[model samples]
Target: MPADGIIAHLRTLTHDEHVEVAGVGQGRRVFRVDGVEIDVIHRDLGRHHVGQCGSCALRDRCVEGFWALRVDHAGGVQPCLLRDDLRLGVSRLLGDPAGLASAVAEHVAAFTEGTL
Candidate 1:
């Protein structure tokens, strides 16, 4: 798969069940599963996103890869972006600690089972 493909997959992962960990222009942010820094931008803060900030100044530069999302375990919903380096880091972490992925999957499965 292409490099961008990896980031895209990571992005999808966030959209699916993970939480946000970092925001754009907020410097490097870390993830919970592993200590990887991912670049993050707001999804709603897209190019044509004329919501807040009295009109986005960096709208142009904030087009592609604009909004970043990651996971946050603060007991609430948080949006963050998983940068490329972070993504690669997580992929590595999962291999060594199969427990990491299993833990998450098991939790998800338990939740689905409604035994919570």
Candidate 2:
């Protein structure tokens, strides 16, 4: 299938490579190469429909968690798409590495075994 082809191609990426079969909704594959992440999106499976977000402390009632690292909107960039309060202007996001890392750490900490 197409996924097999994608896997085969991914295996060919040599040197400083780590692959994570991502467990998020739609279940993409993430290739980490020298600290950079390359995500390959696949078909949706609705896995997160009843998981992850439900268990996260940062969310409130069906709010999606970790669906995106950052979303670029017409207004600005948002750390979490569902949370308007987390919005950050491009310059702010670029300038605040500590804030970015904290946000990412919080999201990472929220990921459960079912969603990791």
The best candidate by TM-score is: 2
lDDT (tens digit, per residue) of candidate 1 on 7-100: 5656655543233434323222222223444543334423322122124344344433323334444321112132222221233344556765
Model 1 regions more than 4 Å off? 1-70, 73-96
Question: lDDT tens string, model 2, 1-116?
Answer: 35667756775883444433344444555676666777665443233432445555555542334456565655355435565655544455557889766755654554433343
Query: lDDT of all the models against the reference?
Result: 0.35, 0.51
Off by over 4 Å in 2: 1-3, 15-24, 44-46, 50-66, 76-116
Could you tell me the C-alpha RMSD of candidate 2 in Å?
Answer: 7.5
Give candidate 2's whole-model lDDT.
0.51
Residue 113 CA displacement from its true place in model 2, Å: 18
**Root-mean-square deviation of each candidate, in angstroms?**
15.8, 7.5
Q: Roughly what TM-score does model 1 have, to 2 decimal places?
A: 0.22
